[model samples]
Target: MRRYGPALLLVLVGAAILRISAFSALYLRYVQAGLRPYLIVSGAALVLLGIAMAVVRRSADDAHDDDGDPLDHEHGHAHHGPRVAWLLTLPALALLLFPPPALGSYSAEREAAQRAAQGVGVFPALPAGDPVELGVGEFSSRAIYDSGRSLKGRTVRMTGFVTHGDDGTWYVTRLLVSCCAADAGTSKAEIRGADALPADTWITVTGTWHPKGKLGTDAAWPPVLDATSVERVEQPADPYEKR
Candidate 1:
């Protein structure tokens, strides 16, 4: 226990640092709101356990020595060895000083932005109404994968950034790619009769899906939506679709 105490302390400090950082949300999902108190108690316990182990080791070394050598000398005449254990505090200190921002433009183009190819059948059918709560990522993924079956005549209401095209028509597009912008593929459902194009404007669209033609320079498979109405909307806190 004495020999391994410093390693255990390092692990506990690492956990504490992660709990207090931007990755806190990820940990909260597993540990719940009690993480703060848990970190406090666990950190104190580990620190005390480590200190006690070090003290016990020192006492044992003194008892076994007959030459009257210092405990530090017996371990290896290095003052910095014990101090190295404190490096575990660096992550916590950095988080306390500078936390990172939420995932932004960097993650905007990830494939996760697109809908999953599998489980398209599990999505609920669009209900007939003025506004329908459609998961834009899921709807787009389904439309892309099983275009003929999923959205041939189905009406959907979606919200996303508006990007302009060369023809003066604005496309309501969401980037779908794996990881980041480099691999991002666009999943666009057209917005006809929409004027006053606004780049990156968050907008709500109510429309019925129809196969029109090619979209963009890639000449990607075109699955257009004949929009009934379009209105600008405020950006949501979690703008991206959660898989």
Candidate 2:
């Protein structure tokens, strides 16, 4: 068992990765969809490597036994290292049995302040529609930086989890990730006309822009939406917006 400890940890980790990346959409919680293929390949490699390692070690052990050698007599001091190494498999087991949830209100609320846009200008005209479906990040960008007022008079819809401010303010929030969850940024809109729902509740909001402060100013940040309708919805399979 000690001889196979390292190989077992590798297999457990590989199995956990495969469980999320190849067998389900659960990988989206920590990485972008485009990364799924890489993850699948890595998992397969780990599994094969582990199996090969275990086979090689077994062959070596059998050779030692055939020579009438005591397996632990000469390496008794090294045995403790393998025993301690078994603890490394706990993280792999946790990933298999209890994969973590996607970032939600708690992650959003941790943002100290919204980062300012690099530049302010007119964005392309929105497609013609009664209610335009927009990502939370896109809406926030247009609201704060568009000098041409792209969102004005437009009924826009966005879906995100709910988060609350200390002042009793609530927001429709989503996290934006450039590469993965570790680099996530928050985007949200303060809802003006609707009652606050429980934190982390996924909701689709339809509303018109409620202009606040001057465009491109910190005071204009977060933006505002006068929600005519707010309906609870199931969380999306891929929760983070691509940054």
Candidate 3:
């Protein structure tokens, strides 16, 4: 067992990486699609490194040790195995036992940077149709940055987790990632009549946009939604949007 320590660590690390990328949508919680290939490459490299190390170690075992000593090696000392390598399995085991849920109300309730802070500029043209369904990030962009106030009369549908604002106001929020979770920005809307819903509940809301504060400027406040309807929905496969 001790002889295989370094190889085992490499294998476990590789396995963990592969698990996140393949087993579930767990990878989506931490990163966007652009990064998936890199993870797979890294995992494969680690696995190959692990296999190579094992082969080399086996080749240089007792048969090749200097002076017929079981542990003597090129460093002129006993080659003890990598005891700390055991720590490598921790992340693998943890991820296997409990793949983390997507960024949810528990975290969004804390409310990081709002869409205003993201410095979004002119929003794109609205889609063609009533109650146009849009991602939370896109919806917030139009509500806050579009000078035309494109959402004034149009009903739009957004899906996100429910959370509470600093003022005990209920909001539907989604985390928008530019690259990964480390850079996630928040997009949220104050739900005018849906405060009764529990925090963290995932829902689809159809509503008209009404800004809580001034729009077309950089004032920090959630976009307002006078909800016409809200329906409980399953959390999306990937809870984040690439901005």
What is the Cα-based lDDT of residue 20 in candidate 2?
98
Which digits, one per residue and each the tens of the lDDT, describe model 1 over residues 1-243?
334546455555555544553344433312334345655566566556656767766776566565566764566434235656666656655544554433333344332333333432334455675455566555555555543354556667888777665576666765543433234455655577556456777788888766543322122333566788888897654344433
- For residues 1-243, write the lDDT of model 3, one tens digit per residue: 677777877887787778888655568888997788888889889889999999987876655664575445555345675677677677766766676667777666565553334444555578889989988877777787677677778989999888876677888888888888887777787888664488778899998887656665556366788888999998887889887
Of candidates 3 and 2, the better by lDDT? 2
For model 1, the superposed segments whose C-alpha errors exceed 4 Å read 1-68, 71-92, 109-124, 145-155, 160-210, 214-242
> Candidate 1: TM-score?
0.47
TM-score of each: 0.47, 0.95, 0.85
**Model 3 residue 169 distance off true place after TM-score fit, in angstroms:** 1.3
Report the poorest 10 consecutive residues by lDDT, candidate 2: 73-82
Per-residue lDDT value at 89 in model 1: 59
Best by lDDT: 2
Candidate 3, residue 242: how far the Cα is off, in Å = 1.4
Q: Give lDDT for model 2.
A: 0.91
Q: Model 3 TM-score?
A: 0.85
Error of 1 at 226 (Å): 6.0
> Which parts of model 2 are misplaced by more than 4 Å?
69-82
Q: How accurate locally is residue 61 in candidate 3, as Cα lDDT from 0 to 100? A: 69
